[model samples]
Target: MVGLLGWLISFFVLIALLVLVVYQLMCLADLEFDHINPYDSATRINQVIIPEYVTQGGLFLIFFLTGHWLLALLCVPYLYYNIKTYMDNRHFVDVTEIFNNLNWEKKKRLFKIGYLVATLFLSLFWLIWSSVEDDELGF
Candidate 1:
């Protein structure tokens, strides 16, 4: 039961993070191609960053509080990175510095997308298998 609940919550939060990363990725591409002004691009990216942090932090916190230790443990590294960036007050990209950091920013988003996809798959696999198992047991 706890496993089902953990995976279910993880599934939704992972979906949300995937969307955020992909959106950030699109914004980075546009900024790179001169399709969007640096100010607007930075602003958009910054807009998403806080919510991403909050949502991600909330996800892991929920896991920990709910006794989903494995899931919480899996998320610790990223959470720690997020905390480090926050503590350094460098979590958001600077508008004037956008051009200089474009490649690095894109790579970061790509890495996040990769990580989120991997976690998403794990949650999805459990969700599917659990549902099928439940159906088999007629519960």
Candidate 2:
């Protein structure tokens, strides 16, 4: 029962992360066409960034401590990149600086999209493993 609950939470958290990354991608694409002002685009992307990391960091702790060791390990590389970019002061966009960093920002978010896709796959694997374990245990 507990294992099922943990797997569900992890799965949904991954889904939520996926949504945020996709939104960021859309905002970046819109900015390319001037459909949205740079300030608005940067602000929107910036707003989602922190919450995404916080959720991911929390997910990491939950996964690492709750016996989802493989998933937990998979979270580390991206989380480390998050921390590194943050410490280097390169993650956020300033309204004045947005144009200068637009290309780099897109590259960064693209990498995140790739990471999220991979994470979703591992999460699905986790679900499959959990389902099989539950069946064996008669849960």
Candidate 1 accuracy as TM-score = 0.91
Give per-residue CA lDDT, model 1, range 1-139, as digits (tens).
5557766877888899889989999998999999999999999999999899988998898778877687789889989989999999999989999999999999999998888888778778878887888778877
- State which candidate has the highest TM-score: 1
Q: Residue 3 error for model 2, in Å?
A: 1.8
Candidate 2 lDDT score at position 59: 82
Error of 1 at 24 (Å): 1.1
lDDT per model vs. reference: 0.87, 0.85
Best by lDDT: 1
Candidate 2 residue-wise lDDT, 28-53, digit = tens: 88988889998899899899988888
Q: Candidate 2: RMSD over Cα atoms?
A: 1.5
TM-score for every candidate vs. truth?
0.91, 0.90
Give the range where candidate 2 is weakest over 10 consecutive residues by summed lDDT. 90-99
Show pairs that collide, candidate 1: none
